[model samples]
Target: MTRRISKTKQFIMMNPIIQFFKFIYLSLKVLVIVAGGHGGTR
Candidate 1:
């Protein structure tokens, strides 16, 4: 778990754009859920 955390930290530091996209994706996911749409595949 610690290794995964460190790897993610390095990934965030190496490419901030990826982080931005990830954040946007998460936000959109939350918005979709809140909007009561097909946000999840379940």
Candidate 2:
């Protein structure tokens, strides 16, 4: 039970950093797709 609590606390601490990286990754993916689409059209 104590280990679970500590693990949950650690996850809570890391959640924001994880979310930030996920957001950056998603933005990069979108940018790549948009670039590809523009290049293909031209």
Candidate number achieving the greatest TM-score relative to the actual structure: 1
TM for every model, in the order presented, reads 0.50, 0.49
Whole-model Cα lDDT per candidate?
0.81, 0.79
Model 2 TM-score, 2 decimals:
0.49
Clashing pairs in 1: none
Residue-wise lDDT of candidate 2 within 1-42, one digit each (tens)? Answer: 246568777886579888798789889999999887643555
Best by lDDT: 1
Alpha-carbon runs more than 4 Å astray in model 2: 1-14, 38-42
* Cα deviation of 28, candidate 1, in Å: 0.4
In model 2, the Cα lDDT at residue 2 comes to 44
